[model samples]
Structure formats: C-alpha cells, structure tokens
Target: MSKPRRWLVAIAGAVVAAGLAVPPSAVAQADEPIQDPLPDPVPSSLGLTVAEFAQFPKTELTPPPPDPPPDLRLIRHARINHLGEVPDGSGRLYVPDLNGRVYLVENGTQHIYVDFKAQFPDFFSGRGLGSGSGFVTFHPDFKRNGKFYTVHTENGAGLTKPTTWPSHSANPFLHSIITEWTATDPSADTFSGTRRQVMRIAEARQVHAIQQIDFNPYARKGSRDYGVLYVASGDGGQGATTTEPQQLGNPYGKILRINPTGTNGTGGQFGIPSDNPFVGTPGALGEIYAIGMRDPHRFSWDRATGRMYLGHIGEHRIEAVYDVRAGDNYGWSEREGEFLYKRNDPQCSVYPLPPDDAQYGYDYPVAAFDHNPPPGHPLCSDSGHAISGGFVYRGSIAELRGKYVFTDLVDGRIFYTEASEMRRGRPAAQIHQFQVYANGQRTDFRQLVGDARVDLRFGQDARGELYLVAKANGKVYKVTGIKRFASCAVGHTRVTGSGGADSWSPVTPDKWQFRGDSVILAEAGEARPGPRRPFEYAVLDKGPAFTNARVDTKVRLDTPVEVTNRDVIVVFGYASDTEFYYAHVSTDNTIYPHNGIFAVNNADRLRIDDQWNEVMSRGAPPAITDTAWHDVSVTHCADTGEISVRVDGELLMTAVDHTFGAGRTGFGSFDNIGRARDFRATGTAA
Candidate 1:
C-alpha cells in the first residue's frame, strides 16, 4: 500500500504499555544463549514433518533494547517522511503530504512547533505533495542563525497537473526543489522565518525523487566546508530507462555535494567545499560526492568509524546496503549489486557481472536477498520496493553497540548487522547476520495519520536515540522497551530405527510437545546447545544407518530437480540438497515423525549448486549431518499467515498460507519425492 500524506504523533505519554522492554540480559550471557521472545504462535499450512522445520542459533548475541519514550508527543500521528538530527543532538522530522502540507516536528515537543504549509501558503498551498522531502537539517550554527534546509517534490507550477508524457512513459516534470529558511529570532521555539529558494531540479517521471541531505560533521564552522550540503538523488525513479549515464550535468542519479550558499552567497547561502571529489574534474558537478547511485533513500556516517552506509533499493532481483567510499562509482544503469542490470529493460538492468574497474565495476552489497521470496519468509521479497538506510548504533544501548539497523519500506521488518563482523578484504563485504523485532503493536504505530498508510522509516538523534518515521500515517514514534515474558527453549529431534527415540530435555523448567518422534522441548537450549547435547534417541527397530546429526555430512543427490523445489523440512540438522542427509528426533523416539519429505528442485540445486546448470554432479549438496548437535524447528501458524523452518538458529524457509493444519506429521519423505528410488524411511515412527 502507498504511504499516507499526514504525519501522526503517537507517544507513550505517561501510560506504560505491555511487551515493551529489552529481552533480559541473562539471555545474552556467554553461558546462556540469547533468545528473542517467541513470535505470536500461529498454525502451519504446508504439510511438513516434525524434523523438517527447526530454529537456528542466533547470529546476534542479543537483541537490541526497545526504543525509549519521547518526552513530548504529537497531537495526531504525522506522516514524517524525513528525519534529521541537529549538531547539538536535537532533531527535526519533516512531513510533506499531497494535501499541500509540511509539518515540522522539533525535539522536546508533542506538537509540530512549526507548520510550514500553514506559514508558507503561497508555495505549498495547492501543490500535490509527491514523494516527501529529505530530512530538515539546521545550519551548522543553527542555534545562532536558526537556518534550516529542505528538499521536496511538488508540481512544476506548485500545483497538481495532468501528465504530459505518454501513459506508458514515466512521469516527468515532478519538480524536487531545495529551499532555505531563516527564523526571525534565533532564541524562539517556533520557526518564524522568511523562505529563500536555494535550488530546484525538475523531476523526471521514472527515477528516484530527492532522497536525503546531510552536512559534513567534520566541516568547521564558517570554513570552506561549512554549508556544504550532500543530496542523494535517484536515477530519475524509473529504474534506468528514464535516464542516462554520463549525464553529469543533471542531478538525476548522483550524490550532489553543493555549497548551498551559491558562489556570491552569504551565511545563509551554501558554500562549496574545495576538496569535493569533482572540484576539478571536468564534466562533473562541482558538488558531487559520489555518482551512479539508484534510489539511495538514506545514507549516514558512523560517528566512530567515519564510514558511510548507503541503502540502495534494487530494481529487480536484489536490495543492497552499501559501505560507500570516497569517489567510488556504484554501478547503477550498468549494474545492480554484483549482477549486471540490462540497460534496455525498462524494469531494470540485466544481471551481467561488470568489469573490474569500469564505472560498471560491480560493488558488493553488504546484505542482499532474492527479489522473489521463499514461502513463509517475506523479508526476501523486494518487488518494486524502497529500502530505508539506518544509523550505525553508537548509543548507550549496550546491545546495539557497533550495529547498523536498516529496514525495508514494504515489509516493516527491521534488521541489523555488526560492523566488527564485516569482511574487510572482499569487494562486497558480508553483513554479519543479526536479529530483529517488530517495533510496536499500536495502531498509531501502524498507520500514517495524513494518508493512513503504513510507514516505517527510522530516525536517530545525536544521542543515538532511535525513532520511527511513518510515511503512510505521517507520525514519528519513539521505540521504547516493553515488558515481555521470557521465551522458553524448544527442542527439535529426528528419529530413525523401528523404535528409535530422541528428545530434547530442557535445562530450564518448561513445557514440551511431541510431534511424532521429534520432541519440541519448550526452551531446550536455554543455556547452550552443548550442556544438553550428547542427546540419546532409542532405537526400537533398524531401517537405514542414516548419518544421525553429524556436522558437515555431504548429501549427494543422484538426480536433479528444479531449483524452486529445494524445500527441505529439517528438524535438527542442516540439509542443502535433496538427498544424502540425516535427521534426529527426541532423545527417545516418543515424538519423531515417521515420514518426511526433502525436495531438491531447481531452486534448491541453484542455491547449493556451485554451477548454475541443473546437474547433480555439477554442484555440491549441503552437509546436513553434524557431529556437533543443533536444533531445528518447523512451526505452522495459520492465524498469522506463517509457516517457518529454522535450523541451528538460522531461518531457512518461511511461507505464508491461509491453511491451518495438516493432520499427517512425521519425518522422512512426506511431500518430497525427489530421488526416492534409493530413498528409504527408517525409524520407529516410520
């Protein structure tokens, strides 16, 4: 759904809400494995074996604490499109809607201290707000000058009009203008000011509108670098079709670093920094920081590392987070992530690998997922979406230290990666896997007040306090901790032999469930996977001497299936291919599945297959059997539209379905029929 126009302000006020605190610190002690609160339980539609779906070890040591409450709250939620932090650690969040409105949310207030739309009716009165403006940042000396800047998209004539381009063509003439404003009094709480035009660029129909703006923190006051503003513009919104590369003169798809004071400007006008990358480069905009960026929604520097993080929304198959370096070319029209995007395709460029040193030279995404998603896991889906960049946590929240938080605008899922774990030598660095949680459950948190749309942009102040900017509802929400019940450990097991038995014994007191021979020990690995390991499963009858829970057991598949069918239902072990894997149930054979399915289709093969072709011998299958024990879980929740499979703490498959339950539940070859000629189901349950 599209975002709303009005911004809403919903604060906790004086009331305390439930489920709002950080998970207990005990959960992260080295001796104990940290666990996030279990997601609201739901039923599963996919008919999976008890051993197919399991949980994995958390990549992050601990989850971040909930956001703190704001001191002041807005009357109604405001659709806050952009967020900016002042040098003094205060912030101003902006909301520009189609209603010809611009609301400014200042720090320390429950109301918009200044409504630009109300104050500047002549400029904003009738303009149909398109994509909202970038964040509003005060001049470096804003405390003294009360000067601030904003970049917004309005109609060419400041009012809505019919499109002049073909219906098939992307809309052009969407003008994104940057303006400067000065407060009448520096000491006043309200923005009583005179508006001045800084710069305006006509918007092309198909590419990115203006994204965000930031002043270099390192620049000294009144120095040449002062007033040096950085603006992240997209490739004119229509992917690559509506714009061209080497169009250096146009500010369509590049990061423009301009001195806002103009050449003959004053303290309010911007001044260009002499050291800007393109200062002397011919054919380049003198203010350009770096070019070839597409839909760079948010970019920020680490207070500690000075490294910049850019979240670039993908055109088709991937969404990437980039660690930007100075003067680096991030292949856009020529490439997306490591793959080549075909220039001719209106949808996006093709997946051709770029050369090593061309502007087309490929830059690796810190983290990326397939545009198309697997069932049960919605985070992988990108289809025509935007990605919001976030800050590197340098906050008092201990768990968030050195972590970068980002989110997808469509799914509302927040994720984080550890800076310490990023690969230093790779062209594309690895985003060390981490954990995430939903922000809040309030309807206000979900809806944009102005347009009633779901907005999930994240903002941070100088103190590193995080806030959520909602686009659909136009509200700013401070994420704070809510009290929650500690999650219990759950056990997963696979069983073999006629009477083989395996079970999970929880170190902590908890409830348990038996789904065939596999036991779901409520919170089994509470401390560590080891203290409870050396698990025993009784064998009543012998069928196949399957490699039972051994680390790194290579499973060789005789035949190849479609990559899309690489669905596996593993309970306690890892399985990448269709065959040659093992399973484990409870220590006893009480709750293990008798039959389960592991399908290695083209998609599965492509995932594990080093070679792209659909040949079994051409690729290697994942080693599912491990000497070191691990936990796996498969949960089906119909009410919430989720079916999930986890292994050794990592999530593998998650599908969404309306179905509630599948009565039959065992392990080994239930729905999967791939390479079954030599396949045999062995175990007491089978």
Candidate 2:
C-alpha cells in the first residue's frame, strides 16, 4: 500500500461511483464541490440535569515549573493528567503530573512514588503543550512483577538520539519516548527501580506528540490483551497539508500495540504484537494497530461492554469521540467528523462529504461536538473547543449510569450521550450538556475554576467513581452524588388576603403596615436584650404547611440606596417566631448577619449557607444593593434539609439542616424598612 495509490484509490472510488465519463483534464478544470464542516448545535432542552461534585479534603499538589511560553491553553500550576487506583489494591490512588512526578495519595496525603524529572536531567517540559512526562500505567500483574510504564517528550535529544522508526521526520522538533520500570518492592510507597527504554520516535513538531498510554482494565488474566500496552500517538502537528496520518510506514498518527517484557522489536527494545493490524503488510510498521488520526488525545475501555472509545481533537471544525476498533481508519486530512476537510485551506478548511465517501473505508465519530466561538472570534482556530476524553459512568451515581461522560478542554463544559446509542455505523449520538453544582449551589466549571479557560481533565478509579481535574487550579474533585429535586404537589400560589391573618401574620403587628395585598415593615426591629434575632417578620397563614417548599415574592427596600444596612427577607420553615429560617437579602455583606441563609432556634441566628466565609463570618456580594424592586425565591426541602436562595433568578446561597420541617412561609426585613408583594408558595403539603 503505497502513499500515492492510497490517495488515488480514495479519489477514484468517489469519481467512478458518480458514473461520470469525463477525462482527467476536464476533472482537473472543474472546481471540487465543498461542504460545511461545522456540526449542528447541541440539543438545548433534552436530557438536562445537574451533577453534584464534592472536593477532596486536602489533595493539592506542588506546582510545576512555570511554562516558558506561558500559553494559557497549556499553562497550569500542576499539569496533573490522570488518576488511577494502584493495581496492588492498597485502596490508594496514584496521580501523575506532566512535569515528571507520580504521587501516591491516601487520606488526603501525597507521597512521591517516582521522580522522573529529577532522575532524567535530559527530560524536557514547560515549553510546549505536551512536552513533559505524558502518562504512566501499571501492568495488570504489578503486584507480582512490580512493572509499570511511562511516556515523555524531549527536545534536543530527538535530533541526535537514534529512533525505533527509520522513516521519521528529517528535521524533527521533538521525540516521544516510552520507558518500562521494574520496582524492587511493589507495596512500598516510594519507587526503587531500574528502567529501560521501550521505544522512541521523532516528532515533526511540538504540539501533539503523544498523549496517553494504558491497558484495558476489563481484560482477564488469560486474555490476549491482559498485559498488552496501547500507545496513542498523534501526527506531531503535521497532518493538515501532508498525509502523515494516511502513511503506514511510521508510528505517527496511529495507535501502537506492543509487549514490554518481550525483546523481539526494533533494536530489541520491545516486542511488536503478532496480532497487530499491519504485522504482515509490506512497508508498514508491525506495531501499527489503527491509523489516520490528527491527535488521539485519550482513549478508554468500557468495563461493562468491553468496547474501546477514543477522544480525538480536530484541527478546526469538530471535536470527536470514536467507537474505536482494530484497524479502523479514522480519516484525517481527508475527513473531519464525517465531513470533508480541505488541507491548508485557510478560509474554509471543511467541506461536505462526497456521495461515494463510503468506498474510501473511513470510519466516523459516534459522539461529537463542533467548535463554537464567540461572535468576533475566528471560526477555525484553537480558541473555541477541544474534546477531553472521559469514561462511562458505571459508578455509584444512579442518574449518571450508562452515560459516556466527557468535557470540553477549553470552557470546561461537561457533556455526555447514551453509551448504548454509540455504535460504529450509526449517525453520531446526540450530545447534551450536564448542569453542575458544588456545595449545593448551581455552578459551571468556568465559575468553579474562576478562570476563562478551565483546562479540565477527567479520571476514574477502580470502583468506577469519577473525578475532575482542574489543570489550571491544580485541584481534583470527586463526583460525590447527583441532585434531583421532586416537584411540589401544591404547585404555585399567590397571597392576597385583604390585610387579614389568612394572607399575612406579622409577629409585631404594630411595626408593620398592611394594604389590600401588600405588607410593609414600617419600622425597624429593635435590638434584642440577649441573642440577636429578627423581632419582626410576617408568616403566610393562608397557605398549607409545606414539607418541601418554594417561595416567590417581589421585595423593595424602602430606605435610600445610600443606607448600606438596609435589607429585605424571605422566611420559611416558620414553626414559630423563635424557630424559623430566613434569607437575609441585604445591601451590605461585610457583617455576619447580612446576605445569607440563617436559622434561629431559641438562640442567635447561625449561618449555615455554603457561600458564607466561616473565617470572616461574612457572605457573598450584596443581594439587594438598591431601592428598586427585585424578584426573590427561597426553596426548602424538608426531606434533605436543603435550602437555597435566588435573587433575580441567580443563585445567592445554599444551606442544609434538619432542624425544622412542615412549616409556614412569609416575608419581611431583619432590621430595616422594606415592602413585600406578589408572594407565593408551592410545595408538598403536610
């Protein structure tokens, strides 16, 4: 299979199927039809839900050396790539940082297992996207053999060092090397071992050298793939104009299968698996398993179904996930996510597929998303999106079961599709966005990271539980649970009781003014003699007692905006004047009693909301900074004792407790003048 014949076969197959009798000269003169490469926008409304993630107690690692170029896309304090439970079953997890250290973590403590950067002075990193310790994986029998492997990149060594493949780039910029290590004691926390080079290959450029390496976790001890290693190699950033992926002579743009313990490979470094796809093909590398990829960033095996999936980052148009199989050709430099990709076309790099595209024998994505940039940004640039590979959730979260969860590398938006719907030949599965929450308040990864680009990654443990790595912040989070709220049976209702107790009941009736359907806190509540508490608040006696309640109302601070102490409140779980919960929506949050969800139980109100800074005894920014009317909502769930407050539809704070249940709802002010109207309550009636 020569390179020229491969191109001719792909082109000729499409032309002959069209039944055209045109000569070669005429075909050359006619312009080739083009197609739009951008994928359809993801489904907006279907399958939308929130996933609750909790941070580990104390697992922050030391920052890596500063990136020389400081490119935000690749910059991070610690470029932590992945996390996996050690094969020895110590119930401990090992995390690999691209800057060259593998840390064994247990009970929020980190111990250095290996220091590749300190050992190998020639190691190169912090200069480019993937120019560091790439990945590490343990052999299935690691407990017995004490064997493991790793991948890393080098700069000057690539030009001078001998490589396993002779057909490498003449002017190589970097080289990716794989090394196998033998540990003296498998159960030890630190590594005391000797390593040997398994394989090395020159890279054309710096960006996409080699990303990940691993073994299929589901493989049995007697299976052929039990200890076999799979290395995902990229095109080294040269596939756009050159057919680097299509060529079969080199390991670039392909997945390679080899045996680390055997010595029958090139230069006697490792063994090329006899079952590899190109073992007998003339002029083809025996190690090639699958070819035709730009940057196969990550790959994983589904434990339940024994299926392999790969996440590939495209040049401009698509970010894809493939149902990978042995010998499959994922067309790159020719097709991008089922659409034609025009090489070196600066203005329009993607086009529609030809009618006879099937004859080319190119496989396509099973779940994919398009690059969506802001209004003025470039259409075909790296600013938009990249696909970060993820695992199927067979974890403890029942709602996330059977979904192939993944994320966008740039904006940190998590997404997923039905793993059962992902098949090789069908149209791509529909992608849906997953809502995220931390500390019980709704949030996105961008907000959680507090950065424009999240630089996010995913990892899974032996128990099938998932973790999220923020490369920008150097933190790991466990997917603790899922948040699913049941709807209230009472639905929605409004208050209008002609100034009677049926609509509103003020604790201190003399301090409040009531009209037809409105109540005003005419005077400020006096300071208590002992424990501070809201001396005046109105309870909605007309509504049924609710176990799970949602309160909606419009509030206006009667004082001037310059009065920084002014506030309005929404009360729920109102068993009595001394036992209730109130959302203190105030103009100033610098004090302990303002702008938070507080609970009173015969004592000073205690702050229980997630957003409160416990050290400072303060909360987030002011919820009511002006005198204008603002919509407020207070939600309470007696079953979980979860309460959250929203101002103008944005989440302000959240709290959880079991102090009270099946109570009334109301509105007022803590110690300032305010007015409330259009009050409503919806929930499961007691």
Candidate 3:
C-alpha cells in the first residue's frame, strides 16, 4: 500500500454545537480530571444538541479518483465503506474499502494491512455496488483462531455457485462470493493470509447483491449466537423497482445465518446453523434468518444493552432503523418505515398487516425518520437521509451511556436516542439533533459532511468511543467527549496551570477566603459599591508561565442585584495588577463594556475593543446573577496577538493586542462577589 495518508481533513469552519449539559463542573470535587470545552447546552427549543466530535488522527486512505459512476455525487464505493474493531485488546480498527484494500487503524494512524488488488488483481477489477470487495468481519475467536471473512464479486474463476440464479438475465461469471481467510501471524503488520471460498451466490443484478456481514459481538463462547455469521443480502434490485424482497425462496433482501465452519447442510458451501429460522420451512431457504427488507445495509449489535439496530435505506420516502430479531420480517417495497408505501402495484406491492393490524407479522421500523420528513413525517423532516447506525455508548460518558448514537448521511444529522422504546417500534425515538463545535463556529451536521448518496457509517473502538466513516470523504473521525482546556496548537504550546497562593496570601483580603482547593471572594462590609479598587486579583503562582496559552476556571457569580456597575472578573496575562487582561463577566449586557474584555496598562485599564460586539465579549449563560458555576476560559495566541474568551464552551470574545506577553494566571472580582475553583491553564511555557 502507498505511504499512510492524513485522511481527516479539518472542516473548513468553526462549529458551535449544543450537547448533554451536566454543567461539567469539577469545582465541588478535587480529583475530577477536568477535560474542557465540555458540553455546555443551548435551549432544547433549538432542536439541536452540542456533542464532541474530532477527526480520527493520523491514518490516511487515498485512492485514485472517480470510479465508473461519474454523475453519482459520491464514489459509490470509495466512501467510508465500513468500520470494524478487532476483538483483540489492541484497539485496532479494520477499515474496508470496496475498491479493494483493508486499513488497520491504530492510535490515529492507519497502515495498509490487506491489499486486495495486489493479492488478487483480476479477482476484484470490477465496478458498481455489487462488483467490488465489500464487508469484512473477524471470526469470534479471531485472536486465537486467526480467522476472518470477506465478501467480494468474482467472475468466472473459482465458480462455487451455479449461474442459474432466479433472474432471466444470462450473465455468466458475475457472482457474489463469501470467503474466509486465515492469517499466519494475525498480530503482525502484514501477514500472508490464505483464503478459502466460503459460499458463492450467483448474482441476478448488481445494485443490491449483498450489504453487510456481522458476527454477534455480545455472544458468549458457547451461546447460540457465538459462531453464527449473519449476512444481509439485497434483492439485487438493479433494474426493476422491486422483487424478491419479500420472497424467501431466494436469499435476497433477507438476513441469512450460517456456520462458517462445518459441512454444508442447505446446499451452500458453509454449513447452515441448525437453529436458523427457515431450516425445515417449505419454500424458504434454510439459511434465511429474517425477511421482508430492501437492502439491509448497516447493522450493529449493541454490546452495552442487548439491542440490534439496523438501518434499511428506504426506496423513496422513508428510511428506517429496526430492532432486528430472528424470524422477523421487516416490511420493504410494500411499506417503508411505518408508511403504507404501495398497496398493490406490479412494480412494487404491499404486504399488509393482518387486516386489524393486530399481528405485526411484517414488522415496521422501530425508529425511522422521514427521508425528507415531509409534513406528516414522524420527525416531520428536519434534516437528513441515509442513516448511519452507531454503537450504544458504554464508555465513561455518563449521560450518553446506553443511548444509541446514530447519524443521517445526507445531512450529517447526529442523534442520540433511548433504545427500549425504539426496539419495539414505538414512536420514533425522541430524536435529538447532535451539534458539533470545532475551534470557534458551531457546525450544523449537514454542512460538516459531504455528498447526499454518501451513506456515512459509524464504528466503536474497544473503549466504546464512536467513530464516523464517511463514504464520500474517505475520512474517519473519532467522536470524543469535550475538552475543557485549550490545546493552543496554533500558538505552539500546550501546558497546564499550577496551583496558586491561598486567598490569605494577599494583605487586603477583606472577605476573600481560600478552602485549599477553591476560593470565595465577597465584598463583605463594603456595601453598594461601584467599580472601586479596579483589580483585586488572586494569582495562582503554580500555573505554568506562558507567552501564549489558555487559562480556565469554573466561576459562580453570587451577586443578585438588578443594576450594578460592578462585576466578577478573572485576571490573567499579567505581570502584576498594574498590567493584565481581565474578563469582566457582569450581570447586565444593557451597557457596553459592562460585561466585556478589558486590559490594564501603565495603571490605565480599558476595554480591549471600544465597541462590545461579538468580536469582544457577549452575555454569560443564565444571566450572570444565576449562581451556577459556568466555565470561563481565556486563550491568547502570541503569534497573532489575539485573545479569545469562552463561557460555558461558547466563544464569546475575540480581541487582539500586543500589550502583554508572559504572566502568572489568576482569578478575581472587582467590587462584587464570586466563587471560583478548578483553575487550570494549558499551553506552551514562556
């Protein structure tokens, strides 16, 4: 494979996103590792969520441009095809490209581990959806067994299945084959793996030959699901509007299960698991696990909570997500999502529920949003098409645990929903649109992603951290929790704050008191005050001195007055009280410079920018009078003489000046009362 490429290209704009807001405060506790830019929230009315998403660092996959389908918005095959994590504790991800290559992703870097083109040149030189290499899954005991499987299209060569498919199209050599390969040294970077043709299905068409193959991740060693490989096959509906989606005679449009090992029981190369639903059924193929679906593309087994969420791209109107089960028939062609797509048309016909609809023999999608969400749509169509299924968050993120994180490929609409109601096809999961904030601007999911046909996909590492695999962009992104500190990457430094002098360290400590880890500053005995005694700063001498970096803290303004010229302030970027930068977080935004940025120079203090526009400072969350401990951070980029301040993870100010460089960071209040703690600063040391 070519040299590793830097796959994740930073989105062109700053994204401000809203997300699960627990206030993300560690002020009350001492050892809560504070990772900042933590999710602050926007009103639920915005119908958007702020969550953390970062591009998977390092690994890159670059392929030559434009495969056959020219006008097709995205390269039908090149887009992030699929993301799978090896069961091995190495935290490696196997990214498969339909264009014939396997990427082993580890620690932000990807190495070409399997080169299909080089290994089997003539075998994969094909096009269209079903003509190339597709899904890949490691055997359950792959770590010890070194076994894995792949699905690809082959013509003429090891012809395992006959060409007498259910279609009239006399196409020879075009067959979809499932093959198993064994690695000599599974843990090595590049190993010579020998392959065996597992099973071959003669193709009728190309569009939906097959979709994905997933081995149950939650199954125990001796459980029924342990060694069973579940494969989703489409009806190969390339030409006709629909056919065979509901037909069990042919394995198309149905999810099939088989034992990759052992002898054949149902005429296929691989042995059929005796527990399969259709084994003794009259006309149904013994391998049929479930039926009545168009293309069962992306499916994931939630290891956290036992749930199977499958996204079946709709024919025209509705896209769906279903809690798949054995023997269940998910209606397709007949009904899309919960809608009655077609009653009876030659092109496509409906399989109505038993008249009273009492028996849901043909299951409806559990959680499906409208493609456009038209007027009567369940979600009433906000944004998105083509669903990207994700794993249930079982990681450290307390709020998102057990919540399924999924996205729409067309609009990049990210969402997290409860699984229980969704599994039984209850009212569409209360969809909460996820938002992304990067650098400065909040990003709308639609704008952050590429093409419409580009069905984005999601993956989870062993750690349960989710990742996005984009088809159009061919990039992988790791979804992480918010960080509370500024990396100061552009400023060339990244460091943390050092502990400071106790509130008793200063002489005029009127009402200021320190409790070892925090400080409380109140204007005790001094009543009805104006902005007197300009800067009453409490410096943390332990914070690393930096020429360019960010300082952060959780502050609670306790003053409740309606009108007061005084404000609580955090002073940083200074040599002493005479020269420093202070953020005056005040209760009222009615007056200019009242709640804004100011700098002290030669004993003269003034607003960094005369006009208090968004370029300088903005209102604080929950009216500064509210006693909630909101996060406040000030970042200085020495290279550009720029300074920015963010409150509760939202950028509120951007100002530039060459006044001060290196200094000790601290917090303070001027003629007002406030409590502050969890003081931290990370950036390059001066």
Highest TM-score, which number? 2
Winner by TM-score between candidate 2 and candidate 1: 2
- Per-residue lDDT over 1-686 for candidate 1, one digit per residue giving the tens place of the 0 to 100 score: 11112111123101111221111211222322112111111111111011101111111100111354221121124335555555543455444332334444554343344554454333321222234444566678777777777765554345344321112234454556677888787555456778876765556552376777777665667775566788887766554564343345445567777777666222234555677655554445556566666777788878787777888876655577777754545566655655555655543323333223222233456555434322333332334345678888787766567877766665454556666554322333333322222332112222323332344667776677676666544445554432111121221333331221332222232333334433332221222222222111111122222221211111212112432222222322222122221232111111112112122222221121111113211111221322233444444332333334444444433333332221112232122211111112221111
Estimate candidate 3's RMSD in Å: 14.9
Compose the digit string of candidate 2's lDDT tens values, residues 1-686. 21112322232112111122211111221235333334333321212233423232222212334645455565565777788888888877888887777878786567778887777766777556777888999998999999989898776645588887643567877778899999999898999978988988888777778898899988999888989999999988888878878877777788888888888877799888888766766667778788889999889999999889999999886799998877777788687766677887865445666655655677778888776444445655665588898998898778789999888877788888899988766667877666576776556778877887887878888999888877767777778777543222434544333455556788788898777567788898777565667767888888577878888888899988888988888888888778888889998887788888898888889988766755444576689888888999888878767676878876667676889887888887867899887777877777
- Which residue pairs does candidate 2 place in steric collision? 35-351, 35-352
- Compared with the true structure, the alpha-carbon lDDT of candidate 3 equals 0.61
Error of 3 at 52 (Å): 12
Q: Give the lowest summed-lDDT range of ten residues in model 3.
A: 13-22
| Residue 469 in candidate 2, Cα distance off native in Å | 1.0
Model 3's number of clashes is 31
Q: 163-234, model 3: which lDDT tens digit per residue? A: 324343556335777778899888877758688877767665556677788798889999989988989887
lDDT of 2 at 622: 81
Q: What number of backbone clashes does candidate 2 have, counting pairs of residues 3 or more apart or in separate chains?
A: 2
Model 3 regions more than 4 Å off: 1-69, 74-78, 121-131, 155-168, 172-174, 238-242, 343-360, 373-384, 445-455, 482-686
As a whole number from 0 to 100, the lDDT of residue 24 in candidate 1 is 22
lDDT of each: 0.43, 0.74, 0.61
